[model samples]
Target: MSASTHWLATASIQSVLERGGNAFDAAVAGAFVLHVVEPHLNGPGGDMTGIFATADRPGEPVVLMGQGPAPAAATTEHYRAEGLELVPGAGALASAVPGAVDAWLLLLRDHGTWPLADVLAYAVGYARQGHQILPRVRDTIATVAELFTDHWPSSAAHWMPDGEVPGDDALLRNEPYAAVLDQLVGAAEGTAGGPDPTGTAAGRRTAGIEAARDLWARLVGREAEAFLARPHRHSSGTDHAGVLSAADVEGFRACYEPSATVSFRGHTIAKTGPWGQGPALLLTLAILEGFDDEYLDPSTELGAHTILEAQKLAIADRESYFGDTDVPLGHLLSTEYSAERRRLITESASHEFRPGTVPGHPPFIPPLRVDYTPPAAATGAKTGFAGIGEPTVQPDGETRGDTCHLDVVDRWGNMVSATPSGGWLQSSPLVPALGFCLGTRLQMTWLEDGAPSTLTPGKRPRTTLTPTLVLKDGQAVSALGSPGGDQQDQWQLLYLLRTIVGGYSPQQAIDAPALHTTSIPGSFWPRTWTPGGAVVEDRLGQEVIAGLEARGHVVTRAGDWALGRLSAVVRDPATGQLAAAANPRGVQGYAAGR
Candidate 1:
C-alpha cells in the first residue's frame, strides 16, 4: 500500500509492489519519482527524515536522519560580515550538505528488496521521457522568473527551455538529471556485476549500492565545490560566496538513530530527534493528554482553542530548546513538566513567547527579531507570487515552506513515512551539469550566539521536515506526515487527534478541516513572530471561528482545502490488512492499495 501527494508517485510505488519489492523499496521508488514530478516541493539535492518499523523489529521504530549539517565554514561571524541579520532563504550561501539521495539509497540498500538500478528506473524514465507539469509548478516558476533572469541565469537556462516558463500540462523533461541517474545506474551495475544468480543476492546488492553511493558523492561534491567557489547574487540582494568545499560533501553521510517517542491513549507515536521539529508535536500531544476528551475534540470550538494554545506553548519551547545539540528532552517530556506547561493554557490566546523552565538547564531564548525585512524585489514590481522560493517567509511577514511526503506499507508489515524537502527549483542557481539546484536548509539556523539552533560549523539545521510513525501493542500500525514547514507537525496533530480520539479512518482524518497557530516565532528566515495568529479552514464553521476570535485570537480564513497535504498508510498485524489515504486539496494526491 502507498499514499502520496501525486498519482504518478503512487503509481511508482505500485509498480515496485507489482515487481515484488517490499515496502521500503516501494517507498524509495515513490520518493525518487517525487523528485521528478514535484520539483517545486523537493529535489535530488534536498534532505529528508524517515521513520520506519520493520517486521523483525515490530514496535521498535528507527529514524533515518538525512538532514545535512552546515559546512565547516558556515558561521555567525562570517554571515554577519556579509551584512546578513538572518540567513537568506534561497541561495547557495544558505545551503547545507546535500543528504537526501544518500539517505534514500541507504534505506533501500538495507531494507528494500529491489536492486539499486531497478528502484531508480521510474525516476529516470520520468526525467528522460517527460511528465506533465502541474499548474502549481508552472506558477512557482513564473513567480521567480525575474530572479532567474536577472541574478541566476543558470536557473533560467535549465527551467525555461526557450527562455520562457512551460505551459501547464506540458511534457517537461530534465535530460541532465536523467543523465545523472543513468550514470549512477551504470556505476551500480558495473560494481555489482549485473543481477545476482546465486543465493547471495542481498549481500551482492548491498555492495553494489555502496559503490553507487560513492560515485554520487564524488560527482556532487565536485560540482558543488566548483559552483560555490564563485560569488553569486543571493536573496539578501548582495553578492556572496559560499565556503562549502568538495570535502564537505564527500565527508557527510546520513545516519540512523533511535526515535524519540511519546505514548498517549495506548498508542506510541515516534518522531525524529530534537534536531528536527518532530519533538514539538510530541510536546503538544503531551500537553493535550492533560485535557479532557471533550476539550480535545478539535471539531468543537473548545477543542480548537485548547489545541491552539497547547501548540503555542510547545512551539515556543521548540524555538528555545530544540536543535542539533543535546537538549534537555527528559525533563520537557516528563508528566510533571507537561502538567506545568498545560497550566499556562488558559481561556484566552497568548501573545507572549513563553518556554518552560527546566530544573537543570534554563530555557535559552534566541534574540527575537520582531521587525525584520527580507530582500525581495520591490513590492510595486509585477512578481506574480512574491516570496515563491520554498514558500518560506511570506511577504506579509508570515513564514511557510513546501515539502513532499510518502507513506508505504507492504504485506510483510514493514512501514515507513518520509518527508523530503529543501532543494526547490527556485532555491538557488541551477547547477548546469546536475539539472537541479542546491538546498537552502541552513537558513533555519539562528545567527544569535548561545541559541541551540544557532549557526555552527558541521551542525544540522533544526529542520521542519518531520515524519511520524505509530505503534500499538508493540506492533507497527501507522505512518503519516504532511508538507507544510512549521505547520507540518501542527496539521498532523489534528489528524492524530481525530484518528486516536474520535476513531476516524485515515481518509476521514485527513479530509477534516485543519488549523495551525503561528503565535510563536517562525523557524524560517527573517524569523518573524505573529502573536495570537491562527490560520483555520473556513469549512470549520462560523461558530468555531467566532469562538476563537472571541478569545482574542487573530484568525485568518484559508479556503477549505488550502491548508494541508497529508498522506498516511496503516497496517494491521493481526489480519495482514493494509489501508492507505492521501490529501485531496491539491487534486494531486492519491492512495493505492490491494
Candidate 2:
C-alpha cells in the first residue's frame, strides 16, 4: 500500500483520517467542510441521518441519530390557521436548530480521535484559500443556480463570482464564509468570546437564542451577534418568508432518542422512535422479504429496470403513509405493516396492472390509508422483527437540511465512509452575513392539504439523506452514501443490491447508472393507490426493459445515469485489498488510492 490509503471525498474528511482520525471523526470534518465547499449540497440549515459500522470501533454498527426536533414552534393547527397555501417559510419556521454541529460534537465525543480544532482546520483552510471552481461543483451550481439566486444573497455572491453565476473554471471565492467558519470554530472551542470564550459575561451574549444558551458558542466571538440578526427565507419555487432573528439561532438544538425504528436486509432490523425513517426502511424491507427471489425474479426482469418497479412500490408507500410514529395516524391493516398483510399485498401485486380494472384486485386504499387505524389484520409477512426497546425518549416531528459524504480504506485494513450535511446551501437563502444556507427541506410535502410530510409547526420534512455502511460477517466491508435529497437512501439501496446480489465489485456498483420509481399507485393487484409511479429507461439491457413493458411500467428514460451521483470504498477482508470509485456522470467527483 502507498504511505496512505484514501478514496474520493471532500477535502476536510480525508484530512482528518489522513492525520489518524478514524472514519467517524473524518466524516464529521468532511461534512463541515462540505458546508463551505459545496454549500449548495449542504450546510447547517437541514436535518441529518446516518449509520455506520467499524471494525476498529466497538458495538454493532451504530446509527448516529440526527433528525432535528419537530418545530416546537410549528403547530399542527398552525398550517391550518395560516392562510399560507402550504408550510410557511417564515424565518422562524424556515430554520431548525442545526443538528450537524451537534451530531459532529456527539460523534467526536464518542468515536472521534481528533480535537475540534483539528477537524475545523480542513474547512477553515478551504474556505480561506478558495479553490478554483471545478466542473462538478460548477455544474451542481448550474443545476440550481436559479433556486439559490431566488433567495439567499450569499448564494448569488458565491455562485455568481463575476456578477453572473460563473461556469466551470472561474476562480470561486467566499472570504465572508471563511471568516464565519473561523468564528464558528472559535465559538465551538470557546476562545474568541472577548477573552471569556465560555460566555461568563466576557461575551456579548446579546443576540441569538441558541448561541446565548451555550457558553461554548461564545467562540463565535465578535461575529455571533451579526450572525443571528439575519433570518432564513424559504427557497421553494413559490411561497416563502424571511424573518430570521438572533434568538432563533441561540435557541437551536439537535434532538435524539435511544430507540426509534431501524431495519436491515428487508426487515425492520432493530430500532425505535424520534429518529425518522429507520423503522420505515425496515417496514418496506419486511414487506419485500415475503417474496422469494424466484418470485421476485420471475415476477420482474433481472436488469436495474426490474428492481426499479419493486422499489417504486415501496417508496410510494413511504411517500404518503410514512410519518413520525407520533402522528397518531392509525395502522394500515391492524398494527400497521403486519406480515400477514404484506403477503396478501404481495400476492396481489403480481396481478396488479393486468390491464382491465378487475373487481377481485386488492383495493387501492391500503397504501394510501393516511388514518390507518388497526382494523387491518396483523401477520408475519409484514410484522417485522419486534423493534429493540428504545433507550431514550426524543422529540416528535423531524428536521430537513443537506450534507456531504466521503469514505476510504487503507492497506492496513482500516476503512471509512463519512456523509455530513443538514442543509442545502445552494438551494436555500443564506443568512446575509453568516455565510451558510438555512435548509428548506420542508418544501418536500407540497400537497394542497393534509399531506403527512407537509410542513406543520415543528414537523420535519421527508428526507432523502441517509448515510450508509455495508458489512460482511460483523466486519466493515464498505462505506457509501451521497448528499441527494430523498435520493440518498434509494441510491444507497440500489448500489448495495448491485454490489452484493449482482456480483459486481464496489467500484462497478458505484459506477453504474441508476433509476427510481415515483411515489404513485399501481394498476394491478391490491391496486395500490401509490403516491407516484416508477419509470425505467428503455435501456440498461434490452431484457430488463422488455420485462417492465410486459409488466406494464410507465417508462421514462433519463440521462444515461439518472438517479443520483454515488461514491464508495470497499475492502475484501481476506485479501485486504481496497477498491474506490465515484460516479462520473452529472453529479460528479473523482476517487483515489487504487
Candidate 3:
C-alpha cells in the first residue's frame, strides 16, 4: 500500500510495488516523481528526512538523515558583514548542501531491489513527457512572476516562457532535468564496467549506485556553485552572492541513524533526533501522556485546548534548544521533566513563550517579534513579495510554497515515511544547468549568537521536515507524515491521538478536522510568533471553536479543509492485513493498494 500528497507519486509507488519492488524502492520512485510533478513543493535541490523499518529488522526504526549542514563559509560573521540580521528566506545564501538526492540514492543502494535506472525511469518519463501543472504550482509561478522576470531571468525562462505564466493544467516538461537523469544513469552504467564480469550482480548494483551518487555530487555541486556565486535578489530585498561552494556539496553524505523514540499509549513512536523538529513531537507526546484519555480527544473543546497548550510548551523548547549542537534530550524526555511541564498547562491559553527550565542548562530565549513590517528598502515596492517564506500556514491560516509527503508499506512489513521539501521554484534563482534551485534550509538558523539554532558553519539548521514510524509488539505497524512547516508534527499529533487514543481508523483519523497552535516562534524567516493564536479547520465544529476562543485562544478559521496534508500506510503483522489513507483536503492526495 502507498499514500502520497500527489496522485502521480502515489501512482508511481503503486507501479513500482506491483513490479516486485519493496517499500524502499517504491518510496524512492515516488519521491523522484514528486520532484517532477510537484516542483513548487519539492525538487532535486531539496532536502528530505525519512524513518523506516526494514522487513528484516522490523523492531528497529532507522532515520534517513538527509538534512545537509551549513557550508564551511556560511559563518554568522560573514552574513552579519553583509548587513543582514536574518537569513533570507529565498536565496542561495540560505542553501545548505543538497541532500535529498544523495539520501534517496543511499537508500536505494543499501536496501532497494531495483536498479537505479529502473527507479529513475518514472521521474524521467514525467519530466520529459510532461505532466499537468497543478493549480498551486501555476499560482506560485504567478506570485513570483515579477521576481523571475526582473531579477532571476533563468527562472523566468524556465517557469514563464516568453514572459507568460502557464495556465493551470498546462502540460509542462523539464527536458534539462530529464537529461540530467539520463547522464547519471549512463555514467553509472559506464563506470560499473558492464555489470561486473567477475563480481556478483549485487556487487555490480552497489557499484552502479555509488557511481551515480558521486556523479550527482560532482555535477550538481559544480553547477550550483557557479550559478549562485553571481549576485542575485534575496528575500531580504538585497543583492548578495551565495556562500555555498563545490566543497560544501561534495563533503556531505546522507546516512542512517537510530530513531529517537518515546512510548505513548503502548506504541513506540519513532522520529529523527534534535537536528530536526522530530523530537518536539516526542516531547509533546510525553507531556500529553500524563493526561486522561478524554483530554486527548481532538473533537471536543477541552481536548482541543489541552492539545494546543501542550504543543505550545513543546514547541517553545524546540525554539530554544533544538539544533545541531549538544541538546539535553535525556532530561527533556524524562518522566520528571514531563511531569513538571505538564503541571504548567492551565485551563486557559498561554500567551507567553514559556520553555521549561532544565538543570544546568539555560534556555536560549529567542527574540519574540509579534508583528513584522518590512523596510521600504527591503520591500522594493514589491507588494506580494514581502514576508514571503516557506509554504507554511500564516497567522491568518493562508498557505503558499508547501512541502510534499509520501508513505509506503509493503506486504513484507517493510515501511517508510518520508517528507521531502525545500527547493521550491521560488526558493532561489534557477540553476540553469540543473533546471532546479538550491533549497533555503539555512533560514531555519538564527543570525544571533549563542542560540542552539544559531547559524554556525558546518552545523545543520534545525529543520522541520519530520516523518514518523510506529512500532508495536516489536514489529513495525505504520509509517506516516505530513508537510506543514512547524505545524507538521502538530497536524500529525491529531492523527496519532485519533488513532491511538480515540480508536479511529487511519482514514477516519485523517478525515477529521485538524488544528495547530502558532503561538510559538516560527522556524522560518522573519521569525515571529502569534501570542495565544490557534488555526483550526471550520469542520472542527463551531462549539469546539467557540470553546477554544472562550478559553482565550485567538482562533483563526481556515475554512473546512485547510490545515493538514497528511498520509499514512499501515500493516497488521498478526493478520498480514494492510491499509492506506491519504488526506482529502486538497483533492490531490490519494492512497492506492489492492
Candidate 4:
C-alpha cells in the first residue's frame, strides 16, 4: 500500500511495487516523480527527511537525514554586510546545499532491490514526454511572472516561454532534467569495464549507483555555482550575488540516524531529531497526554480550545530551543516537564509566548514580531507582485505552495514515511543546466548572535520537513505525514487522536475537520506570529468556532476543507492486513493498494 500527495507519484509507486520493489524503492521512485510533476512544491534542489522501519528491524525506526548545512561562505557577517535584516525568501543567498536527490540515491543504494535506471525511469519519462500542467503550477507562475521577466530571465525562458504563462491544459516537459537523469544513468553504465571485469550483475549495479552519485555532485554543483554567481533580484527588492559554492555541494553526504521517540497511549511515535520540527509534535503529544480523552476531541469547543493551547505551548518551546544545536531534549520531552507545561494551559486562550525553563540552560527568546508589512517590491506596489515566502499559511488563512509527502507499507512489514520539500520554482532563479532552482531553506535561520538557529557556516537551518512512524508491541504498524509547513504535525495529531482514541477509521480521521495554531513564530522568512490566533476549517461547526472566539482565540474560519493535506498507510501486524488513506481536500492526493 502506498499514499502520496499527488496521484502521479502514488501511481508511480504502485507500479514499482507491482514490479517487485520494496517500500524504500517505491518511495525513492515516487519522490523523484514528485520533483517532476510538482515543481511548484518541490524539486531536486530541495531537502527531505524520512523515518522508516525495515522488515528486519521492525522495532527500530531510522531517520534519513537529508538536510544540508549552510555553505562555508553563508555567514551572518556577510548577510548583515549586505544591509539585509532577514534572509531573502526567494534568492540563492538563502540557498542550502542541495540534498534531496543525493538522499534519495543513498536510500536506493542501501535498502532498495531495483537498479538505478529502473527506479528513475518513471520520473525521466514524465520529464521528457510531458505531463498535464497542474492549475496550481500555472497559478504560481502567474504570481511571479513579473519577477521572472524583470530579473530572472533563465526562469522566464523556462516557466513562461515566449513571454506567456503556459495554460493549465498545456503539457509541460523538462527535457533538460530528463537529460540530466540520462547522464546519471550513463555515468553508471560507463563504468562497466572498471572495478569488475567479470560483468557480474550485482557488482555492476553497485558500481552504477556510486558513479551516478559522483556525477550528480560534480555536475549540479558546478552548474549551480556558475549560474547563481551573478547578481539577481531577491524578495527583499535588492540585487545580490549568492554565497553558495561547488565545494559545499561536494562536501555533503546523506546518512541515517536513530529516531527520537516517545510513547503515547501505548504506541511508540518516532520522528527526527531537534534539527527539524518533528520534536514539537512529540512535545505536543506529551502535553496532551495528560488530558482526558474527551478534551482531546477536535470537533468540540473544549477539545479544540485545549488542542490549540497545547500546540501553542509546544511551538513556543520550538522557537526558543529546537534547532540544529545541542538542544536539551532529554528534559524537554520528559514526563515531569510535560506535566509542568500542561499545568499552564487554561480554559481561556493564552496570548503570551512562554517557553518552559530548563535547569542551568536558559532559553533564548526570539524576536516576537506580531505583524509584518512587506516592502513595496514584494507587495506589488511597484510591479503587481504578490507576497513571497515559504509555501505556508498566510495571515489571512490562505495556503500557498507547500511540500510533498508519501507513505508506503509493503506486505513484508517494511514501512516508510517521507516528506520532501523546498526548491519550489519560486525559491530562486532557474539553473538552466539543471532545469530547476536552488532552495531557500536558509530563511529559517535568524541573524541574532545567540539564537540556536542563527545563521552560521557549516550548520543546518532548522527545517520543517518531518515524517512519522508508529509502532505497537515492538513492531512497526503505520507510516504517516503531511505537507503544511508548520501545521504538518498539528494535522497529524488530529488523525492520531481520532484513530487511536476516538476509534475512527483512517479515512474518517482524514476527512474530519482540521485546525492549527499560528501563535508561534513562523519558520520561514519574515518570521512573525499572531497572538492567540487559530485557523480552522469551517466544517468544525459554528458552535466550536464561537466557543473558540469566546475564549479569546482570534479565529479565522478557513473554507470547508482548506486546512490539511495528509496521507497515511497502515499495517495490522497481527493479521497481516494493509490499509491506506489520503487527504480528500485538494482532489490531488491518492492512496493505492490491492
Off by over 4 Å in 2: 1-12, 54-59, 76-82, 88-93, 136-154, 188-240, 243-248, 255-274, 294-309, 327-403, 408-418, 445-459, 521-532, 537-539, 571-579
lDDT of 2: 0.47
lDDT of 2 at 396: 25
Better of 2 and 4 by TM-score: 4
TM-score of each: 0.96, 0.71, 0.98, 0.97
Task: Please say which candidate is ahead in lDDT: 1 or 3.
Answer: 3
Q: How far is candidate 4 from the true structure (C-alpha RMSD, Å)?
A: 1.8
RMSD, one per candidate, in order: 2.5, 11.0, 1.5, 1.8
- Using TM-score as the measure, the top candidate is 3
On the 0 to 100 scale, the lDDT of residue 577 in model 3 is 96
The residue-by-residue lDDT of candidate 3 on 1-594, one tens digit each, is 999999999999999999899999999999999999999899999899999999999999999989999999999999988878888888888999999999999999999989889999999999999999998888788878888999999999999986899987689899999999998898778766675765788888888888899999999889999999999988777778999999888899999998999999999999999999999999999999999999999999999999999999999999888899899999999999999999999999999999989877789999899866545365554534522566366544333567999999998889999999988898999998898998989999998888998998889889999999999999999999999899999999999999999999999999999999989888887777889999998999999999999999999887887888899999999999999999998799999998
Q: Can you rank all candidates by lDDT, best first? A: 3, 4, 1, 2
lDDT of residue 582 for candidate 1? 97
Tens digits of per-residue lDDT, candidate 4, 303-377, equal 999999999989888888988899998899999999999999999999999999998777889888986644545
lDDT at 136 for candidate 2?
47
**Predicted model with the maximum lDDT:** 3
Candidate 2 lDDT by residue in tens digits, 100-124: 6666566655555555667667767
Q: Candidate 2 at 241: error in angstroms?
A: 3.1
Report the Cα lDDT for candidate 3: 0.91
**Steric clash pairs (candidate 1):** none
